[model samples]
Target chain A: MTFSTDIHVDKVRALLQAMEAGDERCTVEILDDITQIRKSELHQQLSELTKNLHQTLDDLDVDTPVLLHAKHDLPDITERLQYVLNETQKASDKTLGSSENTLGLLEEVGTMLEGSDEVSKIQPLLDQASQELTNIMLAQSFQDLTGQVLNRVILIVTELEESLKALIERSRHDYDAIPQKTQSEAEQSAEHEKGVGPNVTAKSKLDAVESQADVDDLLSDLGI
Target chain B: MQINRDMNILVVDDFSTMRRIVKNLLKELGFSKFDEADDGATAWPMVQSGKYDFIVSDWNMPQMTGIDLLRHVRADEKLKDTPFLLITAEAKRSQILEAAQAGVDGYIVKPFTAATLNEKIQKIFERVAEKQNK
Candidate 1:
């Protein structure tokens, strides 16, 4: 993939000669010719670079995870994460249902013992148990919040797989033959509006409110 | 105007876990009647068809977003006055501002305590009462 720069060298020599002779018009013409030669040489170099990249990609082992990830691992990971989401949801719901049933039974027991001197002794303990059960139910909300985070991770993995597959597919053809695709403003804004899920770490906070009070203050400031 | 414990409340989120959690919190608050939707797109038709008194929705979803749903509700003459609350992990000031501008009745950041949910719902109803009184 050698580029012939002899024409470029000849053009540069002609440009220097024209400049030395103080011929302004010839100098200008030779300067334009040199610029064109340099442009074509750059184009040739870029084409060679693209060819080498394609060859390198083609030489990659078929078993490499980058290629296999698009075909197998990524979808497998997505399915596994989805399974996690489903199972956790089922567990949370089961806990919630059982707790609610227990609370109901406790209420019935409290009613059955109402107006007895024994009620005072039994009531406080029952109330404490009820509160604990409620707390347990509330704690199950972790599944929801964590599940949202997991959903985002799964989406990112799927996107990574798609990008890898696209890159691999592109490498099989002439790079410049494909027209460059840019995201339209509408598409970009639509993606922006989709909103990122919960920030997993402090670094990704992006000026987010730290607490309910901060949210309240912002809403108040907005006169809502 | 008093807060209606039996108000037809609609809970919307992409995750069933979240929908259940929000419903459980509402139950803890003594609100019994409720409906659920997985996203704003699903909720929209329900909102139009059902005589919902309030809506509690998540900000991020696949088909449609909470803010867009809020806009739709506000733009609809029939449902404009229904209370809309956003419970989401999107805590950015700009997002809060956007929800406020979209006529969201309340905003509660995610992983919120039951106390916060209770208080926000109470505050929203109080404001709604004030407006009705006016």
Candidate 2:
């Protein structure tokens, strides 16, 4: 039982004026038209909103898992985050091990220096320490790997947030509102061809290889 | 033919950290000359301009993909014989097959050890030498 504000007010005023003039037929006709217009307007609004919502849902494929089901994508995100945690942990362990070994080598060098200033004796120890330090630096590569994974997760989350925001904003407006445009099919499909960065859950997937050995085996079988 | 330890190498990856790790590993393997590119797009220009003896690349990148770069290199009459190795996180059999089909000299999945990289590089050089001899 809703009507557009200006139209409803003007129609009611016209019907009252008609009634005052003892124009019963005119008043009845005005009332009928008002009811018909309101019904049509409401129906149009409902259909428009439904269409916009459908478009939003269709455009919400940020990733394969997100495209399939949002709930299903949650566990995948968790697994990706878990991978980040494991990578960071391994990096820290490697860094610590290298640092400790470097420290031990430095201590040995210090003792040798205290005993005698032989360049040959100190050089090997210093070289070993330098190698360990390089190991420490290499271990920091985990940051890059984990950062890429987080960026992907963030992208999916951001896409979901934007879709939800659009839905909310559209729901607040009437049927006469312009529809939000969606991404083209070509653009969405192109994202699939781009390589999926670091398979965090490779162990669980049958299509993905878990190790370099697996890759080597496959390549050898192909005679490469 | 003996592998040249002093040969110029081009390392292509989007991540600077990865490039540094690869460079350090190569240094450990006695390779002294090195160059780096952030992606295949940037690497392709360098590959065209420079006389790189070897190319190591990552698969996924924003502007151009490693596989595309590999194809470009292989198609070039002058650079077709340059050794190209793919080091990437893309471990699918299909992707490995694609690299092989595109004439990749070596393929090493990410999270690979220095030993694996060394082994792959040695094997690639050996095969290239054998092909040249034939």
What's the lDDT of the predicted structure labeled candidate 1? 0.83
Q: Write the per-residue lDDT of candidate 1 for residues A41-61, one digit (tens) a residue.
A: 789999999899889888766
Q: A121, model 1: CA deviation in Å? A: 14
Count of backbone clashes, every candidate in sequence: 0, 0
TM-score, each model?
A: 0.54, 0.64
Report clash pairs, candidate 1.
none
Candidate 1 docking classification: acceptable
Q: Candidate 2: global Cα-lDDT?
A: 0.79
Q: lDDT of each prediction vs. the true structure?
A: 0.83, 0.79
Per-residue accuracy of model 1 over B1-134 as CA lDDT, tens digit each: 46889899999999998899899999998999999999899999999985799999998998999889999999999889999999998876767887888888899988788999998899999988898889
